[model samples]
Every structure is written in C-alpha cells, then in structure tokens.
Target: MLHQSRQSITCELDAGNSNCLTITACYAANLNTERSDLWVDLINVQQQLSLDSSPWVVGGDFNQISHFSEHSLPSVNCYDSPMSEFRDTLSHLGIFDLRFTRPLHTWSNKCPSSRIAKKLDRILVNQPWVSSFPHSQATFLPPDISDHAPAILNLAVNLPTSGTKPFKFFNYLTKHPLFYQTVLQAWHQSGSIAWDLSHLCVKLKKIKSDIKKLNRENFSDIQERVRVANRLLNDAQVLALTHPTQENFLKEKELHDKWEFLRTIEESYFRQRSRINWLREGDHNTTFFHRLMQVRNSYNSIRSFTLSTGEVVTDPVVMGVIAISHFQQLLAPQTTLTSPCSLAWFQALSPFRCPESNAQAMILLPSDEEIERMLFKLNANKTSGPDSLTSELLKAAWNFLGAEALPWEYRSKDIWIQLKQVSEHTGSLL
Candidate 1:
C-alpha cells in the first residue's frame, strides 16, 4: 500500500497513461458499529482532491449498504443512518460500486437456519478511472483469511482493438447552457446561401466542425471539471455543517448548484453512451450505462467476416462496404410490374378497420392543448438527435419553439398515403 491511515490503506498504481488510487478499509467485524469518523476522513480526502489527483479505486468491507437491496431480504428494520452516509459519501465523491460477475453475498453468517448474507465488500472507481480502463473487472473470491469474501479488482484488462468509432450525438452536450449558442456560431460561420436546402446542408456541415472545436476546447477529458467541482463542493458542505457561517452558506449554495449542473451533464453523457431508451433520469446508473456501452460495443463489433466467395476480410472499411452492399442489394428497388395483379385484388388484400367510418375521416392539425399533451407525453430522457436537440430541451424552450411545431407533421401508415396536391410561396432575397 502506498499510504495508510488508522482505518484505511491507499495504494496508487500507474495504469495506462493515468494513475489509479486504491483505498481499502474495514469498518468493523461485528454487525453494528460506529464508524462515521472513518467515513468522514475518506470524504475529506475526496473533497480536498487536487486538479491532478489520481483516479480513485476505493473498496473494502464497508460494513453497510446505502440501500437495503444490497443486503439479503432486507426490510424497514434494517435501515441504518451510517450506511446512508456511506452511500452518500460515495455518490458525492462520484464513485461507483463495481458489480461482480455473479450475484453472491460477500459475507455469510455461518449459521444454517439463521444464516444471513450481505454484500458488504465492494470495489468502486470514479468516472475518469472507469473511462480509462473500461474493461476492468471485479471478482469475489471465497472467504479464507476472514469471514468476508475478497474483492479483487483486475484493472489492467485490455479490450479487443477496433477501428475508428462512428460519430454519435451525445445527449449531455445539449445540457450545457451554451450548447445552442455554439451551434448558431458554427452555422453563422458557414456564410450566406441562396437556396434553402443548400443553406441547410452547408450550415449543418459548419455546425459539426464548430461543435468539434468547441468540444476540444471545453471537454478534452469529460470528467476533469466534474471531479474538481465535487471536491470543492465537499469542502464547502463540510464547512457549512461545522461552522454554518453566512459566507460559507452562500459558497455552499453556489457549489451545490454547480455540482448539480455538472452531474446532469455526466448523467446525459452516460445515458447517450448506454443507448438504453427506457431508462429514467435521477437514478445512479453511470456504471450500468458504462457496462451497457461495453456490451453494445462488443456485440456490434465486426472483427472479421468471410464473403460469399470465401474471402476473409478484417479491414474496417472493407467490412463496412460489404455489410452496406449486402443490405443495399436486399433493399434495391425492382421495376414495378405494369400489372402485377388486378387493382381489385390489391385493394381486397389491404387491411381495413371500419373503413367506411374511419378511412374517409380526416383530423385537422393539433391545437395548442394537443401539442402540450404530446410534449408532456414524450420520454425526456431518450437520446437526442444530431442537432443535439431532445424532447426535454424542446419542452423547456416551448415558449419560443412551440408555435413552429405547426409545420411538422406525423404520418401514420394504413395502406398508402396519397397527397393529391401541394402549394408553396416563392420568394427571393432583394
């Protein structure tokens, strides 16, 4: 161990280009014990973190759980304040509980009838550490030296090498207050265009370039600012609790608000990366999202594939072309037969539900009330589009953009849509 204290031992090891600081500590051997002092110190270190502090790898027999689910068949009586504090401490410090391969209790009370099991030991890491070593795994070994199972963190695992990744619009980028302004700045730099469609295409291209430059300037490493903010917030909170001075109160509020803002950014980053559409907001699922991304990356990866002519191809460009060609061929348009079948026969095959009453009926455009309902019904946490626009943003900016939704239309499939006629006004710049 590199550093040790009364309750914990810390060992910092260089992993890849960054360093990992592993902290292990034991609260107590018995079921219930007072260890708030130990937790306070850990939080203290987490709060006073420097700009260049190593990625944290904290784990041990914490002897508590933030939520009852970590313990076996828990109920109301199993609640503990210190355990809550422990959970909060990890969360406030931006640490995550690394899940084991198999779900099992780390410590079991050796009795048969009254046997009790709990997951008291866990290995956790910050966002920076997990991002650096995405393939890191944690395993639970059988109890030997003590009653608790040894939690082993294998941090040096390497993921299979793949080619350049595709560009994906991150939902979190939209959370920043300047996100919309940045897009406008990029679009404005594209210069004036005479035609609407051509202007749109050019503006979009310029916007992408501007966004890239903005990202490079603002977010080289995603969690660098977040860690610093968390540390400052921790210090401010501790001071507020201990002293409760007026100046400290204002400082705590500022830090708290800033931390929350950064936290939402972090959450959006994970959500987009996870690609899980049904997930809700305000849940502690950063690690879950990280794992989901890993699984998705593995599942969607094409290491190598053989063509129909038995030619094995491993080049990413070749693989992409082959896959694209295969799909394009399948979807390639065939000449429509002048008369594949009688019109009566095709009409008879079409699905109809009360056609006489519903098919001919037409509903007008939605009103303000209907539009409001539609906006509220959307899942705000779902992924955003390439423009970094999301349902949540649209809802928030409804005052400005709500009326513009009149031009947008939603089409439902019945048999085939037939737009009989359309009209447009033509105009030119002076």
Candidate 2:
C-alpha cells in the first residue's frame, strides 16, 4: 500500500518452517520539519521494525545521501546537518547501510543535454541477517520507465558457520588476581621516576609492535588486538587506582592513557589528511569548513582549558590568534627603546640657544650640523631620509610655536613648510 510522508508496507515470507522473514518497503518525502516531527517519525518506523520476529530488511529510496562525499556535481549544494541527523537515527536503531561498498552515482540520465546521477536509494539490514545471507548483493538496475533506477537485491536464508569458538576477553586473564599483584609488586620495586617512565614507554611500544606484526601477518583482526591491549591497560589502571600513592604506577598508567590518545590522534590525522587532499583538488571551501567543525567538536573529549575570564573559547579563529600571538611574543625584540638618544637628550646637548621669555638666560638648542646628525639617526631607524623627517619635524615645531615666517625669511621656509606638510600628510614621516 502506498501512503504519503511516512509509509511502510510490511510483508511476510512463507519459508516452510515456523521461521519467517519480514520485509518493509518505506518511502519518506523530501520536506523540512521540526526536529520533534523527525524524531517521532524515526521512532515510529523503529518501533514497527522491532515487531518482526524474523530477519528484517528495509529497502527503498531514502531521498538522502548517507554522506557529503556521495555527491559529485559541481553546482549541487550538499548539507551535512540533515544527513548527520539521519545517520544518527539509523545508528540508534542498530541499522547499518548495506550500500556503502558501492559507488554513489547509481542513477544517471543518458540524455545528451541533461545528465544527472545520485545515490538516493539505499538498503539497510541488521548485521545478523547480513551475515546469514553472505551471497546476497544489492545492484542498481538500468533506468527504463522513470528517472529513478530500481534496485535489485538477492537474499538467502539462514546458514551455519564452521565452528563456535570460546569467548576470548583478549588479555583480561593476564590481569588475574595472582598475576596482577605480582606486576604491582614489581612496579612498586621500581623507584626512579625517569626509569619508570622509560620502562613503561618501552613496554607499551613492544605491545603496539606486537599488534602491528600480527595485523601484518593477517593472523588476527584489529578488534581482537585492541581488546587485548585494552585488557592490559585496564589491569595497569586498576593497579594504579589501588596504589594511589605509588608514583611509578601512576606514571605507567598515564603513559598507557597517552598511548591510546596518540593512537586516536593518528587515526584522526589520516582521516583528515585524505579529506584535505580531496579538498585541495576541488573548489569546496564550504565542505572544508564543515569538516573542520567536526574535527573541532572531536576535541571536546580532550582536556579542557579555561580562559582568565572563566570563558572557554574553542573557536578556530580564537585558537589561531592565541597561537600567533604567543609566537610573536617569543620572537619579539629584547628592548622597546627605538633609539639610543631621546629627543630631550638631543635638545639638551644643542649649541644653538633659544631666548627664553621666563628665564634670565637663553636656552641652548642644537646647531644645524648636530641636529642633522641626530635627525639622520632617528630617520635611519624608521627608513625615512634625514632631509624629509627633519624638515617635517621642524615644520611641526614652527607650527607649534605659532610662527608664520615667509619662505625667504628662513632660506625658503615657505617651500620647506609646504613640502614638509605634504610629506607628513602622506605618511612619509620617519
């Protein structure tokens, strides 16, 4: 039965025995709704699917691309918010995308003028059902009647595996009551801090190397190796927790935690490195910003640092400014003084004298040659010639003194004043 907005038709397959399979064909319209409505719809679908006793398979055109990478059109605008929310919904309901292994462009128009393709259709199945149907595969059929291409998926019933192995808890057994206490005793015996850190680093490195060797040999899966390492780490953590005062145990525990954090960082670096290479080749600054936000959000799990005002500023721009300012401070010159001689000091050493109105004696100013040398030194520091800066400073001095002396009065004073004002106004001041 077909319905609007949210509709799913459930069908039961008659497989001889009491065992049966239920299939749901669902279709959701492309329309924006309030978050609550979306949540309600997702919950309704999930509850309906949960009623099935047999293997459940949901297949239909979801009208959504699971990721931004699925779209390749230059002009097509892709948004991550809705897609991210949808993925979260699927994950919350224990559903895995069955179409992840194939290319994103499933439907393409063969028309000469308008050519468009998109992977709006998808198939989601439970892991147990997927494992049971090993030979089943989903394929996009050729377009014939409509713009969308129908997807065909082959299905199989339950199958048995080779053997049932015992549940392995990795290295959990190594931290048994007897072995853990022995390791703790040995750790307590190691007294030196530096030696303890070095030893812990060596042990962690050896464990990681062993895991890598096993992975390279294709002997075990990553989950197994991680489980084993995690057990060992948990044992170390327990010992540390038991002996809070033991410095060596605490150091070893910290080292183990750091190794895990480093591994996470390495994984994230590789993930972003691939995305950055793709972004460099394409004009997708918007996508780059979106990915940057995701990475920044991931940093929230790390240690938190607060500002002086007790506000936490995690924005990239603020972080970048802090980093740049720190670098500049580190590289700044040792002294703030611009020149060896102050303006007052130079004035005091002058030979020329200015007649004072209040004082009985005349105040001595610098001679033309000595003033020229001082001006040269000042202008040298500012990359402006002595003639220009000295001329401007003198004009300013004359203005401050309220002197309107004519050009010929002080050997072309008018021309000098005009040039000086022009230079100062034009920012040519030393």
Candidate 3:
C-alpha cells in the first residue's frame, strides 16, 4: 500500500517486465464539503507519483453522482452544482466509470414508501487501464443486506477485435527538422505525371505512407523514450556528482537536455490528443491531458443502446445495423411525386441575388499567395481528413510547389475547392 486516508487507500500491483498497475479504493464523505478534500488528495497523489502512463483504477463509494440521470428522482432544474467538483476532479485525474452490466443504481435507501436509489458506487479507470484491458468491464451484483451493490471488475474479458483505426496527423511531427525532408523525399518518389488536383491526391496518399514510417521510426515509443531518457539523465547526474569532472558535468547536461526534449514531445503528444486549448504549454500538464483524453473516449463511446423495438443491443455490429436501418427509414422519401414543382411556379417567386461585385468575389480564383496564407492559418493539430492530408504537410510542401502555377485543365475548380476549405478552417478560429 502506498497511501491511506479516511476517504481513500492507494496501492500498486507490480507485474513482470516493469509493468505496474495502481489502484485506489475510495469511500468519500456524504457531504459535499468533506468530499472536496478527497478530490484534492487524489489529484495530489497522482501528480506526486507521476503515474500518467500506468494503468490505474479507483473504485468504491464516491458518494457522488456525475449526472442527474443517475438519481431515481432528479431536481426540477436538472442541475446539481456539487457534481461539478466531482466531475472536474475526475477530468483532472482522467478517471471514468467502467461500462457496466445491468442495475445502474448501485446504492439505494431501504425505504418502503419514499425509496431513493443512485449510482453512488462506481469503478473508474484511466486511459492506460482502458488500453491495457480493452474488453474489461464492471458488473453490479445485487445487494443482499447492504444498501450498496457489490461491483465486480473483470480486467480481462474476451472480445472480438475492432477493425483498423483511422490515420491521424500528429502536429508534433512538424516540429522535427527531418519531417520536411521525409515529405519531400516521399513527394519525389511519388513523382506526379500532371500537376492537377488528381495528382495532388495521389501524392498525398504516398506521403501518408512515408509519414507513418517517420512516426514509427521516431515517435512511436514516445513514453518509453521519455522514461529511458529520464533514467539516463538521472544516471549521468549521479555520475557527475560522484566524479566532479568537467566531462561528466557536460555529459549530464547533454542527457538532461535530451530528457527535457523528450518530455516536451510527450507533453505535445497528449495535449494534442486531449484537444484542450485552455491549458497552454509549459505547465507540465501531460498527466492532466492524458486523463482528459481518456475521459473524452469514455464519453464518446457507445457501449450499448436500446432499439425502437425495445430490444437492447450490446454488440457493436448489431448496434451499427440498427443505426443504419433507423437512419435509412427516417431519411427515406416521405412522398412519391414525379414533379413537385414547375418552372412557372418557381418563376413567380422573386429571385434573391447578391451584388455583381460580391458574386464575382465569391467565384474569384485564389492566388498561390492567398492559398498559402490560408493553409498556414489552419490548425495543424487537427487530424488529417479522409484524404490523409494535413495543414502541416501542405505548409511544409508549399515552398517547393509554390513555384508552379495551377494547371489550366482544372485550375478554377481546384483553386476554388482549396480556397473554400482553407477559408472555412481559418474562419473557425474567429
């Protein structure tokens, strides 16, 4: 056991090959004021131990409900102000309830008339836990004598694997000096026959392959690299202290710089994934960002849903089938009409038209300078589109491509598309 208090107790479970798991058993105070301390203590422990990469789980009675739906009888306003502290703490710690089986309410008041039930007990885990135990789940067994149900956490649940994950462009790659070189090399290898939109599409596809190679080579084991770098830096510092030699001091400094560099990269990695813009860089917020990403995944996931036919669907395949069927039915043609309107009826309505100057401006072909400006203005952190093209790639390749003018074949069409996309992206910032 690492630490214990009235509210919580934390411990670490060690496995072979340096794999470790952290677990915390929490039983929070019933009152909001006392519960706040639990939140602070948990956050402090996490920060102190630097357990960002370790699989961690915190389970038991939190004496808190995240949402109003968790309560059998909710407030009229549908807002619980005290819940914010608990939610924010969980966000900061990156803890989320494990998807569970049946009986959502874990605790109930044993009252015959004025009965009350709420999800006061939960098993929450961080992102690393989810990654390590992808099919893990919690089940709330029926309560016997006690009001609270016993929660069972299964770490290893056998399940079919999901298909390929979509490709994403990491903005941190753009900071590396070799990134541009890699893109240029890929572009040369994918030499285009014609400089048109079609050619750009093919070139981008080729670039995506090389970009993946770059990530695998340099950035794939970022967290591991950070750990190794820190270890090396610590060893060098110790050696420098023991030897007190000029060479040893220089070695320590070099390793320290490398460690710092790797840490920055790790921070950027999680920060980008967290999609948190409020917290600026240089705050040592990698842990917070890491947890926030987990929270987002937990929130966005669709573990189970009920169909219109009153059948509960837990299987992803069946859920998808139902979703598609519903959307198809909902969007299907409501009426059968060969001709809904005639030209004469349309001609009776006054045509709303923009000024000639505005119309011309809307269709104006974008210059290379204008396109370059908009591309640079885009958020490089955003994931690449289905085309596997990102703002970072375009900005880096722009210098080489800017010398040539758009091909006359699809110049207007391509330029308009490029301009529209870039404008929309940049406008979003405003």
Candidate 4:
C-alpha cells in the first residue's frame, strides 16, 4: 500500500518569472512493472510539493498512461485500472496534464516485431501556475537512442514592473486663495467664545421648547436642515482639489465651505444641548457616565480633594452643600411643580420619580425611603446572620430599585432551532 501511494518528482515553470521548480520521488519503475512503486513515488512527490514554496512542473516516463485511449496498440494484458488511478491522482493533486499536438507518441516498442507505441510519458503543472501562462504547449521530441521520446514544453513569462501610486494630503484643498479666504472668514465670523457659549445655550433651550410645544409643528425640517448643512461642511474639506485652476471648482468650493461653516455651528449647538439632555435624563450607565461617577465617588470619599493647580479643597461636603444650595436658588424660578429635577439634585436628595412619562408607560424613580424599605426586606429574607447594611442596600438597589422587567415568555422548539441555526451561521454568542 505504501509503494502504491508514492508519486514522482515534478518540475514546474513559473510563467511570471521563468523560474523552474523541480522535485523527484525516492523510487523509480519501468513500464512492465506492477506500478505499485509508481504509486509510492507519486505520494512522496505530493508530500515534497507541499513542502516546496516555489512553483512546480513534473514530467517523466510516469510508467503509467494517463488515459486508456492513449494506448492505441493491442496488448493481451492491457488494463484500464492503472490509467484511471493515474488520472484520479492528478485530479486530486490539482495538477493539469499538458496537451500534445505533434509526434503524440512518447514511448515506442524496443523490439522491431512488436511495433507498439504509447503516449505514456507526460508533463504536468500546478493549475495556478498554468493560468499565468495559458499559451504553454507540450510535444514529444523524437527519440535519439532510447525507446522513450523526450517531452518538450514551451511557455511565455510576464513579470510585473512598477509600483502603485503614492498618497497625497494637500490635494484635498482648493488652490484659489479667495475660496480659502471665504472658508476662513466664515470660521472667524462664527462668533467669539463668550458669544458662542451664550448662543449655544439659548439655541439648546429653544430646541427643548420647540420639542415640548404640544402644537403639531414639524421640528424635523429644522433638524434636517442642520444635518444637511453639517454633512456638506464635513465633506467640503475632502472634496476641494488644490491642484486644479477651474472656475467651476472654485465656485463649488466656496459654496460648500459656506454651507459647511453654517452646519458646523448648528451641529456644535445641538451637540452641547444633547449632552445636557442626556445628563438630565440620567443616561449615565455608559463609560462617560461611569467616569463621572468615579470622580464624584472619589470626591465624596476623600475629605480633602485637592487639585493639581495648587488649589486646596477642605470640607468637600460643605462646598458641595453650598453648590447645591446655589443651584437650587437658580433652579427654583425655572422649576414647575411637574418639571423633572436635574440629575445631580435628583440623585443627591432621595431618588424621587418624576411624572414625566406618557399615559401609556410610567417611569419608576425610587425614593431613599423606598430604598431603605427594600433594603430592610432583603435583609429579613437573608438566611445568614448579620449582613452589613451597605451590602443589603446594594442588593436591593440592583434588584427591585433599578429597572422594571417583563414576564417570561416561552419559545417554540422550531423557533429555538431556527435561532440556533442563525446564531451558528452568524457566529453570534447568543
């Protein structure tokens, strides 16, 4: 079985480099032999090919014919089994047998009386190597002295000569100074820091008022205008080409730059408001929120929280109480009986639910009293003795006081099977 599986050394030509890769098997066999040695030789050849980094082509007596039809002469012991196995082996290795056009017979009978001729000798190449040189041709050269004729192969080689283009950054901006000046002027005219800050706050308040107004006004139009302007400005810097001297290009640059500046201001204002709204909504579970929480926790824990700027802070709670009192003074005039409290004040006092939800769904806010009650209930339920008040409070806060949950629903077997299949196909963990 080992002898039956070995393959012979093969030579391959790289059509791209005219480089030749040659490999040979450990064993050799004659035409009249059992061909078990040829099999072993072929297997070894395959193993060698796998180890080889260079392209390869193999050609030799092969001892076995590739096709039954290649053996035209009548022989009493002719068998198709060897030919079929050879063809299968070639197919399995992804090797292609070269087609011969002239003097097709690769082997001839040594004896004059037998007059047998067979195309047993063949040339093969790795399929990928052949694709680069599709014009390759194989032919049998006339025998000089031996009965076997030498196979001749010819192919063309084409090599790459040049590298790809390099990248340029300055090509993104317009060459004209007037257009450039317009963009700069727009940026400058945007407003001073103090003016912009005040304007940003005012715009944010207006946006909130617009949203709260029960009238059927389409704020989406204003939002879209702001969005479109910002997009134009963001892309203008990328679209402006500095090399060209076309009038149309300058006009386009000027138009886009103006629009971009307008959009940028609007976007900046909207972003500031969005951040304030996000804080007010207590959407602080994200990384930014956690970072702020860490800072606050550190401040609360440390009695002396000093700054790197040589400012010493003594009695942090006293300062915090003072700040809260100042904030309350400012908030009272704006605060309505139904208005939601700021996140800082809301969290600082006992947690109180704001009646800001629609009639369909109610938002739950747990009070400090309710938190204490839940903590007591959780402590009573504990089987172990004497759990700390902090531990009990934490457990209650995480469970009942955090958020609402829906009742459990069972899925059908088919749905579960489909879900599992989808998860497996998409490589999803859930």
Candidate 5:
C-alpha cells in the first residue's frame, strides 16, 4: 500500500500459497476528474511503483466507465477524457476487471421513470493476480444502506467436487456389463457430421451427454445400493451357515462379492476426492491421506493478511492483487547497462540467411495423423486440466471421432499461426 486517505486506501500483501506481493486498493474517484484530479494522482502514484509481473487491484466508485456498456444512460461520446485516461492507465498497467458473478452495475441513480444505472464501481486485477488465483471470482451483494452494492470476491478454496462436472471416462466405467454396448448404442444413435478437425471435440462433447444419461440410470444412489447389498449378504450367510447346502454357500459367496464390489466403488469415490496417492488401494485408512486434505485446504484457504503498510486485509481479491504487485516488483529484471563490446559483437553478427523454403518447412504444421497419435499417446489415467478431461475418454471414442472434433477444441493451424505472430511480436517488443 502506497497511499491511504478517506476516498482511497492502498494495501500490499504476501499471504500463504502466494509467492508474490499483491496490491489491494480502494479508490473513490472524484465525480469530475478534471476538477479533483484523483485519477491523475492515482496514475502518478502507480508510476512510482515497479509493477512488472505484479498484480494490482483497484475497486470503488470511480464515477467513470471504461466501455459504453458500463454506462446505462445513452451519451454522445460515451467515453469522456477522464474515462479514456482511466482505461489507458489500466491498459498500460496490465490491469483488467476481475471476473465477477453478478450484475455489472454497482451504483444506481434512483430515477424511477428513467433509471440511470452504471457500473461506477469495479475490481481490477493484474495478470499476476490471475495467475495466483485462477478460480477467483467477484460477486455483487445487495446495497442496504448505500446506493452502491457491495462486491464480494470468492477464491475457489473449497475441496474439489465432481457434481455435474465435465464428462471424463473413469476406469471403473469400463467394468460395467453393458459399458461397450451402451457406448456403441450412443455412438450409432448420435447424428453424423462432416468429418473435420473437430471430430474428437464433437464426439467427446456428445459422448458426455450419453455418459451422463448412463450414470443417472446406473450409478445414482450408490450408497443405498450398498446397504441393500449388505442386507442380502446377511440373508445368504444365514442360509449357508444353518442349512449348510452347496447352493447356499455359492449364493453367500456371490452376495459377499457383490457387497465388496459396491464397497470398492465407495472407496474409489473417496480416493479420488482425497487425491492422495495411496498405491495400496485395498482401503484408505491412512493418516497421510487426511493430512493431505488438510494441507490442501490450508494452502488454498486465506482468512486474512497484513499489508506492508500495517493495514490488515481479509478480502481474497485484495490479498491476491497485493501479492501480484509485490512479485511484479520482486521478479522484474534488474536494470543493467549494455557494454560497448557486447554492442559491437551484436552489430558484427550476421543475420540468419536460411532459405525461405527451409524456414517455411521448419514452421510447417504437424499432420493430422501426427496430432491424433500424439493426443492418444498423452497419459490417459491422469487429468491435469481445469476441465478435468481424461485421455482415456478420447482414446475410447477415437473411432467415433469426426474431423471437426480436434479443431473444435484446438485448431492447430490457427494456433500455430497465432504462436508465430506472438513470437515475432515478442521479439519486436524486447
């Protein structure tokens, strides 16, 4: 935090799980920036701080809008000089509006006939802030005393859940009696489209629906089934022990196996939730497993943090921003002077003279077959993505894939072209 006043309070923080410093700030911009110059002062103050790779956030009633959509009332220009300056400052500082989960407008001018509502308040986070808390989100709460609604920041700190989660093929699904048959029916019923790069994406996307339906029919109420299995097993055991018949013993064996199978399913569910690697998977009764869960919740959880300036912060977004700003300052490249000899050497070195054809060949796009093979080769058992997509599902649905599937999710041709552009742009900027 660099400044603190009635209208604004700045805070800097470095909390657990965040390696960088974050800047959390609240700024109440003067209604007319030209009259008060609050925005100008903000820009000047930020100029004094090193912000490379840092995260900074500013939220409050700026009395300004970056875009026309933010302003409810129609205006001739929509962007005045003050709003334009504010937008430009954000662009230069690499700050963006935090992802929020409520209405954009934070203030309301109680004009019953012609309500003049505008997003006068907002939270902005720098790139580093986003990197630190990818699941962070903002929500607008009801305005009770004031006209402006309060915005709440939610950092996804809760344990992961699979409820309505994106479809991913589990190894256990293959054990079902009609697993392949169900998939076959779903595939045959699914309408065919032109085979294109999106074949896998399309097929996978459609398969999720079928999988969901199958799960609803077969996998729901698993615990209830387990209890029912236990009752049946008890009856079979009684007959086996009292009657002492071979058929009764076989029935008892079958019931026990069924109960164990149900229990195994329950274990798999918890193991996935625990996310601890228990190679010996007969049962999950380890202290380490519980400790892992505690650790995850601990590292991810953020109750409060204190800024370098002594102000305590409880908001997650604020902490995230302050940490980002701190890291940006910390990790920024140290300033150095170029030696004359180095400059001379650079001037003497010849430019690359490779043939245009060779350069083009080097940048050529990978073949579809190569890409498909690579996609399948990626490990199937593990998922390391936000979507939780597993490679097993892709491999299983490979035969049902369409040409557009790959392109739907990842258009290699477009991605490669964009990458080349980014590379060239990066060189120029450097």
Candidate 6:
C-alpha cells in the first residue's frame, strides 16, 4: 500500500512480466462538502507523484453519478452541481470510465416501493492504462445482499488468431503522399492487353499487389512505428539536454516531427478501420477506435450455427461446408418458369416500350466522359471487389484507363451488361 486514508487507499500492483500498475480503491463521503475533500486528496496524489501518463486505475463507490442518465430519478436540471464536480475532477486527473459489462447500475437503494438505482461504483483509468490493457473489461456482479455490486476487472490479453482475410481498401491510403504516384506507375507498368476489360482487370491486379507491398513496408506495424518514433524523440531530447549542442537540438527537432507524423498516420489508420463516421479526426480517439474495432470483430464472428436437422454445430470446417451448400442451392438455376419471357413478349408490352430515339441512344457506345462520370460516382469507402480493386484506386488511375483502346466491334450494350454484372457480383468481367 502506498497511501491510506479513511476514504481511500492506494497501492502499487506488480502483475509479472515487468508490468507494474498503481491502483487506488476509493470510497467517497455521502455529503458533498466532505466528498469535495476526497476529490482534492485524489488529485493531490496524482499530481504529486506525476502519474498522469502511467498505467493507473481508480475504482470504488464514488457516492455520486457523473451523468444525469446514471441516476434513476429525473430532475428538471439536467446538469447537477455534484455530478459536474465529480466529472470535472476526473477530467482534470485525465481519468475516464473504463469499458464494462454485466449490470449497468452498480448501486441500488433496495426500496421495493420507490427504488433508486445509480451507477455510482465505477472503474476509471487513464489513456496509459487503456493502452496497456486494451481488452480489459469491468464486470459488475449483481448486488444480492449489499446495495453496491462488486466489480471484477479482467485483463483479457489473449486474442484468437484469425486466418488470412480478403483484401480491403482503406480510405486513408488515398491520403498517403506516395499513393497517387505509386499507383500510376504500377498502372502504366502493367501495360494494355487486347481486350479493354481484360486490360483494366490486369492493371488493377498489378496495382493491388504493389499497394500490398507499400502497406507491408510502411504502414503494417503502425503502432510499433509510433513507439519507436516516441523512443527516438525521447532519446534525442535527453542528448540535447545533456550535451547542449546545436546538432543535438536539431536532431531532437527532427525526431519530434517524425514522431508527430507517425502518430497522425496511426490515428488515421485506426479511424478508417473503426468505421466510425461521426467522430472527426485530430481528437486523439485512437484508443476508442482500437477498442471499438475489437468489439466489431467479436460481434461479427460466427462461433456456431444450427443445422436443418435440429443440431447445433460449432466446428468451423462444418460451418464452411454448410454455408457453401446453402449458397450453391440458392444460386442454382430454376427451370420452373411456366413461360419464359422472349423478345416478342417484351414487344407486346407497348405501354412499357422504349422510345425509338432512346433505344438508338442506348445502343451507342458510352463515351470516355460518360464512363468517367460513372466511375467517379462509386463510393470510395466501400469494400473492394473480388478483383481487389477499390473505387478510389479506379478513380486515381482513370487518366491511364480512360485512354486505353478498345476493339471496334465492342458495343455499348455489351459493355453495359458487363458493367451491371460487375456491380452486382465480384466486379469482374468474363
């Protein structure tokens, strides 16, 4: 134990593998006047010991709720003074509520007639603590006998490894300085084939390989890069301080700039993967994004499925087979149509017949400008097709692709059919 008081006790935790953490178990006073002192005391501990950027946790009954929704009782005033004070204290200490599971309300008044429930007990930590234990969760057990529920913190370090996943195009890659040049170079290097559609597919496939290489070389280990940059910056600062030379100061500045750049890139990378559109960039929301990504992966995972024979199957291989069989059956051709539609049937529908001029226009080959407009209309952030080509990549290399020559026999009708097939399925041409 590091510090002890009537309201709180602080301790240093050593969880093996050189991972040390400082924890504080606190119980604030019921009265606002006395509870104010507890807040000050906790802040004093934090400031005096310089624990701002360290792995630290403070958990216990705060004797108050931070948000209005936390309490069952509604009030005319949405912002309560006591709640505001508690929130401010936490904000000042760089502490935020840890992600939790199980019971939402931790404390109840236990009154059957007019019961009051509030989330007064919470585990809070700083950014450092979250980074150290990214998958940690606090589970609040049911308050059986006592009014306050017991909270258990689990540091889930082990994560299940997944197999090779399909290629996905991230929007942030477009923001890279070398993106446009690298893609254009690869596009030209692929050259053109006899068929226009085949030529486009070949170019796209080539660029996809180049893009993968670019990511592997520069962007794959972003978090590790951030750590290395930070370490280098710290070392340079120390050197400048000890030697006080011009060269040392210049080196420190360069390293500081490099660290900031890498940090920004890392933030953008996770932000795209998180798929959160509301939150804007530059908010230092990387920790939230990282946790959210994990949550999404867990939610989307298929652990088990029930078969048609009233049996539950958890084996992955069996599940894959089941999925394949289901899709194959669904997509199999149907011969049950009593009367298949023919050209005469379409001509009989005079009310829905196309106009003569419109029919002629439709048959005419699509111009480069028309095709470019359609390509630009595609959603850049959407997942890549089976060809591993994204809308963003197509748009970026349009200058080269739009000028490519096509055989004179190719008609607009054939191109339109192919385009429709690409849109509906794998975005690949036959």
Strongest candidate by lDDT:
3
Segments of candidate 2 deviating more than 4 angstroms: 1-6, 15-18, 34-39, 48-54, 75-78, 99-103, 109-114, 157-430
**Comparing candidate 2 with candidate 5, which one achieves the higher lDDT?**
5
lDDT of 2 by residue, 1-430 (tens): 2122444565766555554665667665666354435445645655765632336667786666667666656676776777877777777766555533234566555675877677767777654444345445565665577766677776631122223431211222231234334333433343322222223323322333333333245324433544566777777777778876678586767768654643343333333322333333223243344334343332222222246675655454565566567767897646667758787888788777655663443433334455445533442113223222222222323222112221123333253554444342323221
Ten contiguous residues minimizing lDDT sum, candidate 4: 401-410
- lDDT (Cα) of model 4: 0.45
Instruction: Sort the predicted structures by TM-score, highest score first.
Output: 3, 6, 1, 5, 2, 4
Writing each residue's lDDT as its tens digit, candidate 6 over 1-430 gives 8888879999999977888999999998999999999999999989876778788999999998898888787762387899899999998998887777566789988898988899989999877786677767676887888999999988762333345776766655766789888877877787754354544555666667778877777777899999999999999999999999999999999999888877777877677666776787778788788866655553355555667675767566777788888887888645575867898878887868668999999767766566667778875545556665566665665565545533443344466665554443336221
Residues 1-430, model 3: lDDT tens digits: 9988889999998854676788899999988999999999999888877766678989999998898888998562365678877888898997778878768999989996988889899998878887676667887888998999998987655542355765777777876779888887877788754355545555556677888888888888899999999999989989999999999999999999888877888888898888887777878798888777766655456667665675667776776777778877887646666867987787668677679999999977766567667777887667556554566666666666444324455455555575454443323221
The collision pairs in model 2 are: 350-366, 352-365, 407-414
- Candidate 1: regions farther than 4 A off: 1-167, 179-220, 234-253, 276-280, 333-342, 348-353, 362-372, 383-393, 396-402, 408-430
Q: What are the C-alpha RMSDs, in order, of all predicted structures?
A: 13.3, 26.1, 7.1, 32.4, 20.3, 8.8
Clashes of each: 0, 3, 0, 20, 37, 0
Q: Sort by lDDT, best first: what order?
A: 3, 6, 5, 1, 2, 4
Top candidate by TM-score? 3
Assess every candidate by TM-score.
Answer: 0.48, 0.34, 0.63, 0.31, 0.40, 0.58
What is the TM-score (0 to 1) of candidate 3? 0.63
User: Which model, 1 or 3, shows the larger lDDT?
Assistant: 3
lDDT of each: 0.61, 0.47, 0.76, 0.45, 0.62, 0.75
